[model samples]
Target: MSTNAYRGALLGIVAALLLANPAYVGLVMDEPRERSPTGYTATAITPTNASDQRTVVNRVGEEEVLTVAQLEDANEYSPYGPRYRAPERAAESLRAAVESGTARTTGEGVTFTLRRVGANYRYLRTHADDSDAARYHRFDVVRTNGSTVVTTTRVNRSTVAQYLVYKDARLYTALPEYQRETVDEVIAADEYGYRPYNDEFHEVTESVVVKNGTYYVFTTGVHVDDFGPSTKTVVSLLLAALGTLALVTSIGFTLRATRERRDG
Candidate 1:
């Protein structure tokens, strides 16, 4: 009875902590029709000032180097600059191409294909070595249709693990609405697969369709990825620290209560 009571209390504490977390907790149902039966098309987003952006593909789990485009100028290369082409513009072009069946995404043994997904402003981070880098967040997709499940670790702006399993449209149609919805959210979160069930990160991950109008708020200095999960090492260390603190505090209190009982 004592052990049961302690376990219950511990769970209660965990629930309260998670409830206090700002990131909203979402529940997944069994509806499988949430996935959209849409095909993708590739659009060459070339800049007036062509620069080199390498498109890497891993086929059959074997890394393959595709043709890399060279950029001669940054002025008109990507609208958002060579760093980023702006999310809205890229999203618009890609969506249109796929809808028209102009952008047919294909490749065998290809687990991940990162076409020049529209480049977005990713804070150009600098290293301590005085080196400079212009990094941008890209929007990429993993093709799947029922029998061909493509699951990716979403790394957007959030604190959850998003596992997207894409298959044939025919297979997607058979999924229950809720199940499909869950899968869509997972893909949207992209890389959120790093942490799927954490509720205290203040990062709400809503699995969504690529076309869905979901965006993340940005903060200056350190733009926390509001889309994907954090590194596993960092997350695990945080949990361990919290666990140790909780255990110490609980033991201290129990010992104090036992001492009082003896004294009385």
Candidate 2:
């Protein structure tokens, strides 16, 4: 009945409505939601289409989007490509194994050992230790003045009075590293199996670029969703609603107290 009550009710409704939809509030308040750029100078890979096998274009001034096969083709492939471990580290392991005379076995009982007298020698299990001895094979590490090589034989035999040196034969690769937060955000925004199903709804929030021959990373989130709102969306809305209710209740109590004072 009082002006205070009317104003309180109006304020409560307006606040509740604004709190219910943050996106709407941002739009009305002219607040842009674009993310900040990563200081690293590198391009980002962005999807260009809504296809299941979406094409992606490099954000570094490249407008052309490559197909799934095209992207795969662009990726370098090597039989001895860089892995998660360094090749030098693997070589160190080999040296340790040789010095210890006990090769590291992969629980299959297949042993790899190295020995160095005046000459270096390496041995690989042709089969399990419990297998037939006759079927076993031994390898000789031979080093010439020019080059080093490994020769396999059915049995250990005398060489041509040459020097034998163990050559590290393990393949190694450098592990790929990226911005963890960017990678996680992109993966979270993506559909299962990195599909493009969520592309129309979700998008990259921030682009994280790493230069100097390193992996580029980016962050993504669902800005708009045609399907039912995500759990995050629901929780955000609930929090906003609670906050609005609390503020509105406080304002109403304050106004009511003021009205009582004026009437007194």
Candidate 3:
């Protein structure tokens, strides 16, 4: 009836419209849904010589025999350190050994020689523009008795897409069709989701594979978030709640003013 009453009515109408907006309503009702595969298969093979000593031959025609721990320490936060150089030299030696039809052995009885593949390094260098290009390592497990060969097994490891090879067929087959499809697609393309974060790119997918009874796990260096309420949804719900409260208060004020005028 009065100017204040009319303004209250208008306020109530504006608030009601806001509360009824599809975007606001949708935000309030939004529920979390599955985004990606949450479960992962475990590795099938366990290494028996993890603690064994490894002899590394440097580029200077000198032998630098270091244990696994020492090798790790040499490369810790040091880019061009011994650990980094070791792989390149090891790959060269491996190539030489392979060409000469000889087995490169280290440690005691059963020797396991692990080295980065020279081809992968060259590929990465040639395709420097390709972000999906990854490095690979070659692992050879050899058994010898008094200079006589017994058995040997070789396994290839990819630094990026480790899950490319599923050693256990039954485990892979047990996965749901959708998951299997995703894994297969990632492996086939040799590419994983790379998202930009703070001026840097990060990998979002993780994978694992087992070969020759050895387990290898690798990820895109980014952790995938679980299903939860998104930031936008939370903000929408908050704004909608405020709008509803404003509508209710405006309606109450208008009704109270009308009753007062009638009593006057």
Candidate 4:
């Protein structure tokens, strides 16, 4: 009818189109879905009859990343640290093998085990490379000059004892005679659905919890979220109410404008 009425109608149509657009609807009307519950709360840890002094040697996974310095510092020295083959011991072993008629005649491809494999420091004297020193304990059995084979160093000593080992964002603690419990269900419920499985990453705390003098360790980065089922439902209802109000107000405006035009 009038220019003002036509302009108002055009704006209403544009607004309605924008609100009903499929892309807009898809973006804003995403069906609320469940999110992975991760992380842990302090309350999740409790006391139990399970002994705290539990010893777990292979608790660390193979995928865990460790620097050379970290590995070496884990104990007295790195497990993969440098090792040395003593020249005197090597010669003696070869001599003994020859006396026993086990030595090769050509002095090539001779292989024998020497009990006196020197420490990492001995290898450091000859090798200038820092990497070579880092791998002093682990030796490679290699073939050299066609027939000669090089063997790794060896020792008759038992494995070292370590109570704590932390690498690659993971910490393992082995204590004796302590008792503790892990309440995952309680934690999940209380913390609003964050549940961490065994050995999974948890970001809630840097220090492991010790329950009643017992020790517990959490692995990986854990996160806690405020959004859950109740939150989703409230948001959805609020959006629906706003949308209904917008629609009703637009219809009222149109009707009132048309009535005014007819009266005029």
The C-alpha RMSD in Å for every predicted model, in order, reads: 21.0, 20.1, 13.7, 14.6
lDDT of every predicted structure (CA atoms): 0.29, 0.34, 0.39, 0.36
Clashing pairs in 3: 45-213
lDDT of 2 by residue, 77-160 (tens): 435753222323323333433344323323111111111211322333222222233122244433444333334344321110
Identify the candidate with maximal lDDT. Answer: 3
Q: lDDT by residue for model 4 over 34-131, one digit each (tens)?
A: 43456443332222322221111112211221222332223334377433223433444333332342322223212322222211211111122223
Quote the positional error of residue 224 for candidate 4 in Å. 11
Tens digits of per-residue lDDT, candidate 3, 1-264, equal 787688788878888776766555665566544444322222223323221100001110011112223332334657664435454333334444434444454533122224332212111111112123312223233334633221222222232122222321234454456544544443343234322222111111222333243443323423366566676567667767877887888888898888889898
Q: How close is candidate 2 to the true structure, as a TM-score?
A: 0.23
Which sequence of candidate numbers ranks them by lDDT, best first?
3, 4, 2, 1
How displaced is residue 226 in candidate 4, in Å? Answer: 10
lDDT of 1 by residue, 83-133 (tens): 433333333333434334233334432222223321222111111111123
All candidates: TM-score: 0.18, 0.23, 0.31, 0.29
Whichever of 2 and 3 has more TM-score, that candidate is: 3
Best by TM-score: 3
Supply the TM-score for candidate 3: 0.31
lDDT of 2 at 121: 25
Q: Which of candidates 1 and 2 reaches a greater lDDT?
A: 2
**Shift in Å, residue 37, candidate 4:** 4.5
